[model samples]
Target: MRRYETIFIASPTLTDEQAEELVKHFEGIIAEQNGELLKTEKWGRKKLAYEVQKFSEGYYTLFDMNAGPTLIAELERRFRNHDSVIKYMSVRMDEQTKAAERQKVRYEREGRRKAQAGIKERSLEEVMG
Candidate 1:
């Protein structure tokens, strides 16, 4: 298996739930093809650098995984068949970068958990102060 990263832009018109579902759908495809998903990040709605399908904004999602060549081809094929997907790109990840990514994900998850716990234990003013 080779490490790879995929970034896909979906139509901005989709609701939050719809967007989540769309991301999950592609993630499922990767898993079904024996791909191991390392991480998934939702960048939320952002202004596009240029117009695509006449839209100025889009939902951006990133997926990091280890997959085979055939799996990558099928993933791209599905992206082309999905109308809501405005654009998608996939690139192979280097070994050193993949190691760094693993560390980054561990730190991010620990930070998020701490933040959530803090939110439940302190007021906004107390936390900020």
Candidate 2:
């Protein structure tokens, strides 16, 4: 029951409803396969680094779940054979997920430091005197 994250791009030409349906279809597959879907996110339309099937932008969706290897195989197979899918990537998270979580927290703290760097901090003497 390792955690897995999958991100897939759907064609930009699809209507909003169509895109939702596609996401739901994959979710259904996971449920049917007894995979626990932890999170699903639709990133909306975004520009691609390169053209995919003559489209410059596509809708992105992410799925985070815990499941066996079989579910991943089926998901990839569907993406490969489906016309709507422009690109997809899946990664099995081992202990690497914890490292990523720690990195994310550090990144946020660094961002806050950068944003507030211009502000002066109060010294102990300034507070007491």
Candidate 3:
């Protein structure tokens, strides 16, 4: 299994429910192929850097998963055949990117810990003063 990230733009005309359903549909595809989905993020409707299918905005969704190459090919094929999907891109995650992501997550956790500790120390100083 290899880590992959997929970002797809859905038609902006879709309601939130419709967009959620579309996401579920694609996720179902991945699950059926025995893919492990690590994350799914909805970016909401946003202005496109460029127009696609005559639309100036789109609902963006990102998926991170571990799956085989064949699964990715099928997913892309389905997206191509779907009218609601304006554009999509999938990229395999290299080792360096994965390492960077891990490091970033660790740094975020450490930052939060330090912030909480600072708050506690400030409270202590206030009590002493």
List CA RMSD, all candidates: 11.2, 8.0, 7.8
Tens digits of per-residue lDDT, candidate 2, 43-124, equal 9999999998899999999999998899999999999999999999999886697899999999888878967886555789
CA deviation > 4 Å runs, candidate 1: 95-129
lDDT of 2: 0.94
Worst 10 residues of 2 by lDDT: 114-123
Return the TM-score for candidate 3, rounded to 2 decimals: 0.74
User: How many angstroms is residue 62 displaced in model 3 relative to the true structure, after the best TM-score fit?
Assistant: 0.2
Q: Which runs of model 3 end up more than 4 angstroms from their true locations?
A: 95-129
Task: Return the clash pairs for model 3, or none.
Answer: none
Task: Compose the digit string of candidate 3's lDDT tens values, residues 2-121.
Answer: 999999999999999999999999999999999999999999999999889899999999999999999999999999999999999999986768889999999889879989888443
TM-score of each: 0.73, 0.74, 0.74
Tens-digit lDDT string for candidate 1 (3-70) = 89999999999999999999999999998999999999999999999999999999999999999989
